[model samples]
Target chain A: DQQVKQNSPSLSVQEGRISILNCDYTNSMFDYFLWYKKYPAEGPTFLISISSIKDKNEDGRFTVFLNKSAKHLSLHIVPSQPGDSAVYFCAAIEGGATNKLIFGTGTLLAVQP
Target chain B: DTAVSQTPKYLVTQMGNDKSIKCEQNLGHDTMYWYKQDSKKFLKIMFSYNNKELIINETVPNRFSPKSPDKAHLNLHINSLELGDSAVYFCASSQEPGYTDTQYFGPGTRLTVL
Candidate 1:
């Protein structure tokens, strides 16, 4: 049972354009969500996160919008750059002291220069 | 100055063999975890230890054992490996066991069973 799902296996966008990555979750108990960027042969790096209470969070060129009612969230990168090409994994923090993360299969984003 | 490091980045062994993977974190985090990414690219948590104590153990097989000798080091030993055991294993750490804590992951260890 995949609680978190990134239906899109891959995405392509042109440089300086908008890049949007979407993710959905089945479990409503998840209170926190995060996005991670991973390159080949490298581990995932934390990109940004948002709490269930907040609808949106922005950091520089990256923004995350959460729609609790829809049980969906998306990461938007304005003016995407070629270096932004990587596998993006959406994760949710299961409600518990352990803070166990449920990760999606990941979406590979390719930015064409 | 790597925050998280795992030894034996690649491991190849035959079925029914026993092997171990070592992980260390110098970030002074109090929690460590082991995750497996299968061929489907699904990342699943196998075990988590906090301050050298077992805290979370998912529905993993008994053949997989995790040992945390200290807060900074966590090791995994697999016995009677099977073809299904071939996957990439990642080691991660967090400052504390909280939902808000960000985890730092290692480069990952690819285990191949023949």
Candidate 2:
């Protein structure tokens, strides 16, 4: 069964606008979450991550917000650029003895210039 | 230099054939992992190795085997490949065997079983 889920398959936004992608998890044991961006024919690149204790984390134009009560998290890219277009995957880990990352189905984001 | 590299960008073979995929990392990481992205686009972990020792083994078939020659190299060999074996395989590495260490992924190898 899929513990992490991203219901949205695709999203489109104009350049310079804020783009938001959402993800949810059913397992409460996951203590860490991460987001990865992947381009066509290329491997996923690490974007940002957040711990279960922290509610929010920000790095430059990318920000991740977590809501433990809702069992959900989101990735926000402010002032989105055309280069930001790619498939975004949300991954979660239990973080103690297990390092295996459970990845979601992924969301395809398109930024129109 | 490429931090992680995988040989054979694409492989197409008939059913029941045997093949191997090689992966190498120059980042001096101590952990390596193999992940498969199937048709549904779900990336699932197949195996993980830390310092050339098997750590995490998923519910994969016996036809699939992972071998690590050293800390920097991990190879996946599949025998009696089936039609469902078609997928994109990715090799990744980390400095340690923990989630705190960010994993770096390779370009991925597309395997198609006919």
Candidate 3:
């Protein structure tokens, strides 16, 4: 049972264009969502996060939008750069003290310069 | 300095062999966790320790064990390794046990069971 799912295996976009990655979750208990970017042979690095109380959060070029009714969330990168090419994983944490994260299979994003 | 470090970045062994992976965090976080990523790139939590106390243990096999001597170190030991155990293992840390805390992950150790 995949609690978090990213249906797209890969995505490609031209440099300086908009890039969007989608994720869906089945668990309603999850209250916090985060996005991590990972390079080859490296661990995932935190990119952005959003709390259930908020519908959208933005930091610089990255933005995350959440729709509770749809049970979905998305990460948008504007003016994508070549360095933005990496595997993106969406993770969610159940509400309460135990913040254990459930991660998706990840989406590979490629930015062509 | 590395915030989270795991020794033996790569491990190759035969089936039924016993091996251990060591992890350490210099971030002074109170919580540590072990996660496994399979060939399909699915990351799943195996165990979590807070201040050297076991807090979460997922539905893993008995052959796998996690030990934490202190808050900054958490180790995973696998016995009677199986082919299915071949995957990338990541060690992570958080400031506290709550869900709001952000986790820092290590480079990961690739374990291949022959």
Q: Write the per-residue lDDT of candidate 1 for residues A33-77, one digit (tens) a residue.
A: 999999999889999999999999999999999999999999999
lDDT of 2 by residue, A1-113 (tens): 99999999999999999999999999999999999999999988899999999999999999999999999999999999999999999999996865799999999999999
- What would the per-residue lDDT of candidate 3 be over residues B69-93, giving only the tens digit for each residue? 9999999999999999999999999
What DockQ does model 2 achieve?
0.81
lDDT value for model 1: 0.96
Task: Write down the C-alpha DockQ for each prediction.
Answer: 0.89, 0.81, 0.88
How close is each model in CA RMSD to the real structure?
Answer: 0.6, 0.5, 0.6
Candidate 3 stretches with Cα past 4 Å from truth are: none
Give the candidate number with the greatest DockQ.
1
Candidates 2 and 3 compared: the better one by DockQ is 3
Q: Rate the local accuracy (lDDT) of all candidates.
A: 0.96, 0.96, 0.97
lDDT score, candidate 1, position A45: 90
